[model samples]
Target: MPIHSKLPDVGTSIFAVMSGLARETGAINLSQGFPNFDCPKPLKDLVYKHMIAGDNQYAPMPGVPALRQSLAQKYRRLHGCDIDPDTEITITAGATQALFTAITALVDRGQEVIIFEPAYDSYVPSIRLCGATPIPYKMQPPEYKVDWERVESMITPKTKMIIINTPHNPSGQVLLEEDLLALQGIALRHDLIFMFDEVYEHLIFDGIPHFSALRYPELYRKSVVVYSFGKTYHNTGWKMGYTIAPEELTREIRKVHQFNVFSVNTPIQHALADYVNNEEWYSALPGFYQEKRDLFVDILRQTRFEPVDCKGTYFQLASYRTISEEDDLSFAKRITREYGVACIPVSAFYVDKSDFKVVRFCFAKTPDVLEAAGERLIKI
Candidate 1:
């Protein structure tokens, strides 16, 4: 018998593969970009309290009112943008759902969805599942900078959207204002939808400011910005995220979202709203994570592997060219088996790995975990 598959090319995610290997080998589980530490006690307590106070029912199709209002205020505070909480904000299960909904809502069969290579794994699958074509533009290794000319050239009449992630995963590269300007030009010229994934918006380090898609008022009408409480609140399991877009676009995305997850966890959403609205909590995040990033980098400085400068995200890219000539996947497996340290290979994110020799280390663990992993990595 033969079986059909919608995503025949897809398999278990690289994150899952590396994480399972880490578990079996007893390697420090640094392969996945989730926090090993617990979320804020205050946030968790609030959720429990809300549940105790009888707020466990399903929320509004879009999102809980309080949460949406708080999220709108957050956008205003952080990005100096005003979004209508009722019409322009829709919360989903997580940023993943938000991305899927946005893609499904906007993309049509054979339409091109341009994504930067070494991208988050979901982009390609989500685009393909929506019957859209994924046009990957590779970001060069060592310094994963965008090739604007190449990107501009990829924009054709069939191009329906461009997906961008700031504080980019695996590479930790942040999109600059210049990059945004170039993207704005391309989007305006081609009339393409701009989907920005900013789950790591608050995780930027080294005094680099996050560039929001909403910053460009010219492209605001065409942009859908997705953000998550999971990354910011250190609660990946919570899986609560929201998208900000123009009323018209959000309505369509919400249609997909309404049936997808229908609503996020109710009390949790309220708790996150409270947490984000607290100025002190959100304000201190940069310094809080920056210290962890620095400590991890400092520990790896003694290693043979050259750790790339991470401007943002808890993940760091390290070149293994000096350590071994082995390709990224093999090197990653070897490190897990021998060094007892788990990490993700950057090449897995690319369509082709002809010239890439890098792996990604997630530093979202405790200091001791980072130190232990760092010590083992140095010997490799």
Candidate 2:
């Protein structure tokens, strides 16, 4: 009756923990990274039309041809890179599954994967499940800049992959062109595969253009770039996402992906194929989220918490050093219970749970919800 857990150290995700606590305490839950508003009605209508048109069954093992082709065209228009839908693109249940499948396929047992912290929670566990080791490089606060020189110094013969996230979660920092160039050089020099998590690609702000790995030939040659339709359309629950890679790499990824989920939802895939063709829908995302960022920042100015510079993504980090010496997790819980506002402790994103006296709040809610959360946050 004794069961040895593959993930013995892992427990309930902090998102679930905080969200459940928020519900119990009647706090305004901003701990999880999801929109509190509905996606466009037109998108919903498209899904209805597709389902009614009998797209409810299993999609192709790779994906529906229409959705893959649309994504291929999207890559061509956005990154100026031509992708073969039949050979290079595959849709998954979410970006998370694509990440897992890619890692599972590429990372061999006893190999090593270098990851930067504070990373998204899923990265480490996925790497561990592959029977590989994760070599973590800590990026400091106030900037979270990667020291490429230091990164190269940590490389070893056993190192097989490097993972990166842009418009990063909890921190919201984006990678610059120089970072991409450095990563390209390193991956080529060591013959290491690179995985780019760009789920928040469209949420960049302040006129800063996103730098995709697809932009560089060297990086794209040895990279798997993951994207999320759920994140893009503000319907995270739909769990639709895809990955782009070279034909060789994608062939390997599909080996795992076929057994993983077989394919994503057929109706959602059909609807997304039609919806993505409209440039107007996605083009406005940066400006849309930027307004929310600016509004949230402006409101936080009324409080003691110092807001960090958020270049992209809908999450905002605030240092509560002036008000509390308590660790981030404790402060997060205290505020949730007493102030009726819930946020994720940034420490939870790090493997060590390193407390930097910072907490992350999701600002992707409605203006009124943000206003209400701001009122509670300001009271602290």
lDDT of each: 0.87, 0.92
TM-score for every candidate vs. truth? 0.97, 0.99
Q: List the residue pairs that clash in candidate 1.
A: none
lDDT per residue (tens digit) for residues 249-367 in model 2: 99999999999998889998999999997899889999999999999999889999999999998999999999999999999999999999999999998888888999999999889
Q: State the displacement of the C-alpha of residue 18, model 2, in Å, after optimal TM-score superposition.
A: 0.5
Off by over 4 Å in 2: none
lDDT of 2: 0.92
Which structure among the candidates has the greatest lDDT?
A: 2
Candidate 1 Cα lDDT to native: 0.87
Most TM-score-accurate candidate = 2
